[model samples]
Target: MSARSKKINNMAYGKLCLLLLILSGLSLTIHAKLSSNFYSSTCPNALTIVKQEIAKAIKIEARIGASLLRLHFHGCFVNGCDGSLLLDDTSTLLGEKTANANNNSVRGFEVVDNIKANLEKACPGVVSCADILAIAARDAVVYYGGPFWKVKLGRRDSLTANRSAANVFIPQPSFNLSNLTSSFATVCYKLYVVLGLCGHTVGFARCTSFRPHIYNDTNIDSAFAKSLQNTCPRSGNDNVLQPLDYQTRFRFDDKYYQNLLVKKGLLHSDQQLYNGNKADSLAKKYAMKQGDFFKDFAKSMIRMGNIKPLTGNNGQIRTNCRKPN
Candidate 1:
């Protein structure tokens, strides 16, 4: 081989290496922005502290509502105590409403307000009131059998509320199982019905017993009606939750499917994943093979948060979370 040809080959090889290196760096950058895991060497402690406080407040409020409902419905009747039906804030005058109060209707407002006030006092301008409510509502849902995913902080409140966004974002209680799954998928949740059932079954089952009297509202009876009436109620209240229980409820897992297996999964789609041929068959497959669903759930969640997020200096870094000027 000629020396000139050899030198040309070497040059081409070096160029290829350089191109690959650039691509690797680009991939890392994109990954960091997309997920970041709320972990960063350069993450501001103040930011982290604020985020933690926000999450804590949200989690606390959710659990509080859960406890309140649980206490209210102890040994309830067939129609249950209507714990959910009783949740309302029509009593509060609109003139005195706060961001958490007027914008979103939390089940337990008084308790949520106290914590919100504490955060307001501690960090007046650093956090957004919208996020406080969003995270709190999310945790409350988690408290009610929905598992938690890491909520991306740094989102600012809307100056003018988008009613369309609100109306479109939240799923209805009366939504069927297929509709529920479709709604989640419509919002790009990347939910694999089969992948989530393994760890979800137990929690879902407990959720079932939590509202034995909550037969009609939400997806309570229809989804898990057969399992709830057959195994859960027959076995007695003490035997409601099983040993493989995933308790945190804050973390995502396959328990959703397992939950379907044990309780009255309220949604038609959810029930289908357990017994029917489509998604239910897939869920049944996973119930047998215990694998991790976190990776998929997390990836999907990050994508959810990123939807229409402020990027490239488009939004402001508000010193005050409310009433951005």
Candidate 2:
């Protein structure tokens, strides 16, 4: 009931308000760091532009959806999802397209270019190519009957590409279980490695990449291998292509895991997941549950998209995704 008591109570209340303000600011900073609505204000139509471009491309060639998804994975796997894979070779910069894992193997560059061009027109210099790729990947999955997830955005394009790192980091088809596990572990957890392999459920592999498996690998089914060998010769015609999943190549289902169960997985790297290792149980579990595969695939993709993103002035918004500006 005195002036001294009233002053002390007022001081405590002011201190509590200050503390709450600081905590609220920190929470917002973290949330805005990487968010699905990153372009809601800056480029309100960014997601729509990306989805429209992806749908057009998939309509032209359904396989393109898988290629676009693979592009995101390859880019994120090496130096995070910075659109480094989209870069073209230059006098000073040697890009990842020339890497052994990517040379003549990675497809759908034109599709990304199409999306970038449209986005630039809609909201010039607003949406980064890295964010476009991430959103395009989610759209691609939905176009192909796969489960959808909200892609975290605000990633900026990297100023440099790592050609050597791509070769060393990206998993190769010839890789066995040990090599495959180590390759994916470099960028993501062992569990994600399995989910990443599940992406194969929608794509096809070139005959050049799978010939040895169909002809020499003992784990593959005899009839299935013979079927592939009919098109993929032992000696020549390396450019021929075969669906990665014999059952449903275009559908983003768990048939890839089912093929692994039957020793019919098209690639040596794919079968290795079920080759009596820690991943074998996961392979079996996914093989029996399509819903589980869809759920985990969506979760792993969001995690993969979050890897080492360049945001908050860390990198530039590239006008041409292939070159830094």
Quote each prediction's TM-score: 0.47, 0.88
Which residues of candidate 2, in runs, are more than 4 Å off?
Answer: 1-32, 189-192
Candidate 1 matches the true fold with a TM-score of 0.47
Q: Would you list the clashing residue pairs of candidate 2? A: none
Summarize candidate 1's per-residue lDDT along 149-256 as a digit string, tens digits: 666555443333332332443333334444434433432222323222222332223433333324444434454455444545543563354222333344334555
Q: Residue-wise lDDT of candidate 2 within 1-325, one digit each (tens)?
A: 7998865755544434324322331111122368889899999998988888899999999899999888988888888888999999999999999899899889898888888898888889988889988998899989889899988888988999999999998888888865654455434334334455788988889888998788888988999999888888888878887888878989888888998998989988888878776567778878998887787778767767777888887778999998988
Per-candidate local distance difference test = 0.37, 0.80
Q: Show how many residue pairs clash in every candidate, following the order shown.
A: 24, 0
Error of 1 at 68 (Å): 17
- Give the TM-score comparing model 2 with the true structure, all chains together: 0.88
